[model samples]
Target: MDSQRRQLHLFFLPYLAQGHMIPAIDMAKLFASKGLKISIVTTPLHASLLSKTIEKGKTLGFKLDVLIIEFPCVQVGLPNGFESYHMATSPDLRQKFLKATTILEHPLGELLQEHRPDCLVASVMFPWATVVARKFGIPRLIFHATSFFSICTSECLRLYEPHKNISSDSEPFIIPNFPNEIKLTRKQLPELFTQKVNDAGLMELYKQVIEAELTSYGAIFNSFYELEPAYADYYKRVLGRKAWHIGPVSLCNKENEDKARRGKEASIHGHECLKWLNSKEPNSVVYVCFGSMANFNDSQLMEIAMGLEASQQQFIWVVKREKNGGGKEEWLPEGFEKRVEGNGLIIRGWAPQVLILDHEAVGGFVTHCGWNSTLEGVAAGVPMVTWPVSAEQFYNEKLVTQVLRIGVGVGAQQWVRFLGDSIRREAIEKGLLRIMVGEEAEEMRSRARELGKMGNRAIEEGGSSYSDLNALIDNLRSHSFAVEE
Candidate 1:
């Protein structure tokens, strides 16, 4: 058989989080589009969220399959069917959810033995997969659902420990070994990096992941080199490893033929949001969403409502019911919806985020600076008003607002966990105004548009990301031949 015609199979194991799972799905589609057989190993509950994407891949004639393993919910003290971290009723249960996902290693190992894919790609959290891959002699690659910039910053911060001398996390510290002036307050760092809480379990998990990365064959990043060429190069040269920068994976949905065929049926909500956006003026509306897991208290919810109302800019806000402490209507200030009725459209459930951002009417984004959301905003060419809430989001905020220069910060310098510090309406209003109509908004918009164009081109035929993806495919294909021999 011709080398190009040789059969190849790849397995994807994503961390059981929406952010992680979604990008893994997108990566599978991109690979499958190139005629590689792809199977995603996930729980039944997580498989449901991916049904549409999987079906869409089938429609596009991409060889794709979903292998469901039992989710150890009850064992981990989680409610039945609560497989993903986001499915947990509250933020407090997140650790339990993480534990539950870890319990799947045994089951995942059995499945991998059955399928014995040519290569194994897994989320950062599933370091045990590296052991399985090694046992089976399969090439292992870890997928980080973030930008190259985030990886570089996180690694550098971990190595340098620049904040060690600081008495307070709130004190600003300049990060060492960077091409640009990158400064971050100790407070902005993630819990793991802060060195304040010594959770042995968490630290052990981090150690395992770092070891896995060092031992793995390579890494696959859900980011394009064009977006952060300097950092991508730094990651490769310093780490002394081959890292593939093939991303803005959300753009896989931009395949026009597949989109046209299944646009309405694939996502009714996306169509509805786009239709509504069509009525708004160009570059006039602000899009507000805090990602899948970020939650807020009543006061914070009300503050957000007040700020959106105060901004006077047209906006579409995706409000997940449970994420706002469950009582949605009660949380918003009285008469708030009535006042901003026409100017603001509040979506109570999942919003077609990529679709909304891609719309021409979206001018500004009020984001929590999640890596996926940040890249989507960049791909859409919309300037962001960054309000990083928790996790690695604070790190991502600096990448967007400071490194990229396409986003404006909302002064959220600290990681706000559940029931923590609240951002008042004044800060929200100022951030919105800065991104939407302030003197800097235009310049930011221009930069955002430029970045957006670069992101788009990077995924096109013969583009940087496109070439990288093809190279990865070819490398995998060659590996398949070697295995057969």
Candidate 2:
């Protein structure tokens, strides 16, 4: 049995985005640590991002390797480095990037044929993985970088279509047949659920993704069972799909260096950030950052800056660089940096987010509610000011604010594709105040700390996530043996 487990090889295919890739890498590391040979298949550009982490994994004696396939950037008429969705600044470029991923099917299929692993764990974006897995007689597990509650909600919305009767976008409708009485307005729903005339290409892609999930062996979530036990059971029993929860995968990175470099090289030095955090009183700082893909106009950025100032809380704000590479400082209130020099740290690009959040000084997170960010906050045991920007972020916000009760929403009511709605500084200030100060804030912090402790326990020996991971591996090994026989 030990020999068979050692012989098992699992391949992970993550989508070309930071949110997807980071968790996938962590999952791969987890599998490798358990004596399974793990291979991560991705494009050159994406592979480059994981090089450091892979080297570290190898140093720790984990049998981890990366298999790179050429991205069809030239064929799709994109620039050399425009391999990931984060690089696509416009709708046209993003569409072209999606096209390029579709083109990767041939190369990806070839790699799978050459090095057939026992199973394939693929990002939900690549629906073609289902067909490829079938061709090779390998089980494919769909990976969703989200909470069980969100997926359950999505599935419920699909089956019930409860929003169909809403006369106005602002009028809220309850999602039918859910464990929790969740309400969402049409404006907050994804375009797929709301748009009368959806983009034909996008609609088709979504259909493929859904079909892929339905036909795949099962689904893998980067969540802990204890965090959403009801939703986890509901997904498997009600939805009738095989599922596994082996995460808060970020906790796999136990070292400061690993945490700092989890996704990309931090723009600011880790030590410098730590030093700044060390100067602050415990549970006094709010860590503010939108995930890699969120784009805000200058006006919106100005509102955020002002909001942080008005809240009068110590904060570390990570500002994404402008794509065009000019006018970066135009949005700041005059003398804002000078006024808040000691009170705030404005990181121009990527900050060591995991490192920052894990600090005792980081009392609250002002976040876009991206799943990776959401889970990281949960793992860090920090309460949040939820400011969802797009995609399934609104769903995640509900999980934090409504289901978990560890976060406060900033009243962001609309879901645009890329550009965020211009929320006023007042609303932002209010949200921060609710999460960072007062009696309610203390209560929320206590809950967050408990959840964080649960997350840590889930990844430990004999914990829920640990058991799930072992079960998943054993299940795959059994399947492999059956196939051989």
Candidate 3:
């Protein structure tokens, strides 16, 4: 069985986004650690971003490698190095970026044909991978970078069309047949759900993604069973699909350097960030970050700055750098930096998120509720102030604030492409105050800490995530053996 495991090879194709790429890399390393030969297929720029992690994996004797394909930047009329959604600054460029991903279908197929891996685990974004996998008789597993609850909610929305009867965008509609009495406003839904099919081909692409998941062998989620057991069970039993929950995948990074350099280099030095954190009292500082793809206009940024200032809590805020902007930020309140110099540290780019969250001094997280950040906070035992901006983030926010009861929402009721509506300073201030102090905050922290312990347990030997991973590998190996027979 050990030799058979050594013989099996798997190919992972992650969508070219930070949220998607980071988890896929971690999952690949997990597979490699289990003695499976793993190859991650991505474009050059994305590959370069993950180079350090892959080298570290090699040093640890994991059979991990990367396969790079040239992105069709020239043909798609996108600038060179514009390989990720983070770089797609305009609506026009966003369309071109989506076009570029479809163009890579051919090169990806070539890689699959040459390598003939035992299985292909591709992101849901690349629906065309289903057909490519079928051509070679390879079993493809669709990788969803969100929670089972989000996937279940999305599937229900597609099947039931529950929001159609809502009187207005702001009116709440209950999702029918869900395990929980989940109510969502029409405004919080993704554009694909609310907009016309003919608007921008979004519906067409969404249909393809759904069909790919249906046709694929099974699905993979970056969640553990204890986190969403009911939804995990419902997805397979009720939806009639094969799935596995083998995550909190970020836990695969056990070293400080690995955690610090997980996705990209930290904008601030690790030591400097640590030094600032060390100066604060335990559970006194709130760490604020909005993940990789969410962007806000100047007004929104100003509101966030004012909100943090008004909260009067110590904090470390990670602000995304503008792609094309230069010099001082015009949106900052007059003398804001000078006023909050010692009380706050505003990092202007990527911050070592896992490092900060795991620190004893950091008690609460002000997060965008991207699944990675959500689970990282859970794993770190910190409660959150949920501010979901786009994608399935609103659904995740409900899971945090409603189901898990470990977070407070910042009252963001709308979803937009890039520049979302500004949540007022008062709302942000209120959310920070709720999650960072008092009896309610302590109760939330206690619940979050227990869940964090469960997350840690789930990844250990004989734990749920550990057992599920072994089951997935055994299932794949059995399929390989059957083919050989």
Give the best candidate by TM-score: 2
Per-candidate RMSD, Å: 2.9, 1.8, 1.9
lDDT of candidate model 3 versus the reference = 0.90
1-485: candidate 1 lDDT, tens digit per residue: 56688778899998877788777888888899888899999888777767777787787798998999998878978778877666655434766776776788888789888988899999889888898888888899999988777788888888988889777877888878886788888878877887665566677788898999989989999888878988899899986768998888889887533333321132235566767888998999999988877878777888888888887889998775643454547778877777887788888866667878888999999999889899989999999999887778888888898888988887787776533347889989988998888679999999999999999999999999999999988898887777777
Per-model C-alpha lDDT, please?
Answer: 0.82, 0.91, 0.90
Q: Rank candidates, lDDT, best first.
A: 2, 3, 1
lDDT of 2 by residue, 1-485 (tens): 45365479988999999989999999999999998999999988888888999899999999999999888888989978777888887667877888888887888788888998999999999999999899999999999988899999888888899989889999999998888888999999888899653467678898899899999999999999999998999999999989999999999999999999988888899999999999999999999999998988889999999999999999999998633354447788888888999999999888899999999999999999999999999999999999888889999998999999999999899998788877999999999999888999999999999999999999999999999999998899989888887
Per-candidate TM-score against the hidden true structure? 0.94, 0.97, 0.96
Better of 2 and 3 by TM-score: 2
Clashing pairs in 1: none
Between prediction 1 and prediction 3, the one with superior TM-score is 3
Which 10-residue span in candidate 3 carries the lowest summed lDDT?
195-204
